[model samples]
Target: MQLIGLWALIAATLGPFQNVLGWSISGALVQGYDPISKTISDLAADDSPVKWIQSSFFLAGSVLTLIAAFSAKSLALPGRVALFLAGISGFGYTYFPTALVAPSPNWHVIFATIAFVLFSAWPLLSMRFDKRYHWSLRPLAAISATLVMGATTLWFLLTWLEPGQPIVGLSERVIAVMQVLWLSFVIWSQWLHQKKGAPETAPELAYGAKN
Candidate 1:
């Protein structure tokens, strides 16, 4: 079962990863900067396989995650389902056409933002699943999620590099990195939760102590 879960994770990463979402949804940035003189259109072009990679990876990951979560009750069933839903919604939003123009990604970005929030909460909710889950990691994940969510919400009032700056892509990239860390921590934490009672003689051996 562990091998199956790990394999599913690796397979999902082969093509369907969450990061490509930004490629499709963040397309608006490219469109916003589009100019006849500009030579970067190919970067965000839909013709690229970035969408396929993201959509497929996430699709596969969602299915695998569902299977993994179901097979292992170490995490809360509801939380896992929410995570699965978040992953599913993320794939859907990645390709949805919200922009009539070349690369307007508003719709994808909007829905993806919600998906990110859901994804971030998966770890925190996961602690509710098993008593052996690392309590320390739960608080850390919660704090990270809260910070990311709050910062993203207040992005309008506080610009990353200042409003109307000549180049403004750095902030989004930074935020993306932060999101990646937050998500990685969440998933890794669940993986750890799965490990909490592996050595137990019985499933209830150390559930409360580990909690």
Candidate 2:
């Protein structure tokens, strides 16, 4: 869980900063290239400068995310499944790097959509009705996270479809940051709760008769 939270913070921090670094390193050739409007793939195109940063961000983040998903025993089964699919989509982003001047960009769109939806929905799906795990995933908090993420996604979609808006990059960044922060908070909250609630004695002596 700590690993997952740590990686989430690392990825979120790196995501935009890497793009800025790539932009500066690339001489910003793509005219009027709005970082928020243009996709991460733009920074990772074959002709783009500092392509490795974008590639590494997606590839490394995907690996860590997959590990986190598999090891996240605290999440419900559906949440884990959603995260696993999100990880797979993150891998797909690397496989289908979008080119600014490419004849077709649908592949990138498809993969990105998968990633966005899964990540957004995971919070809602992860809500626990049993109350035992409510410390990390209360119904109201999980629902709010899901709704906010979903709305952010809608804003991104609108920006993309409109093409005239200059907020694409900003919207994408917002989504990424929100999800990462949420994941970190959830994991940290769960870890703290577990630590506070744990028994001092060994489990072997839990139900013993005056042992």
Error of 1 at 12 (Å): 8.7
Reference-based TM-score of each model: 0.53, 0.76
Collision pairs in model 1: 16-56, 16-57, 16-58, 131-211
Model 1: runs farther than 4 Å from truth?
A: 1-4, 7-73, 98-106, 129-131, 153-168, 189-211
Instruction: Give candidate 2's TM-score.
Output: 0.76
What is the per-residue lDDT of model 1 for residues 1-211, given as tens digits with 9 covering 90 to 100?
1211564344334322444443444344444543222211123336543444435544554455455445434445655676667656655655552333534545555655566566556655654423345442345655556566556634521442253642234444444445445544444554665665445435477555588
Worst 10 residues of 1 by lDDT: 34-43
lDDT for every model?
0.47, 0.68
Question: What lDDT tens digits, residue by residue, belong to model 2 across residues 66-155?
Answer: 665776557776887898898899888777777655546567678878888888998888777544453457688889899989999888
Error of 1 at 95 (Å): 2.7
Worst 10 residues of 2 by lDDT: 1-10
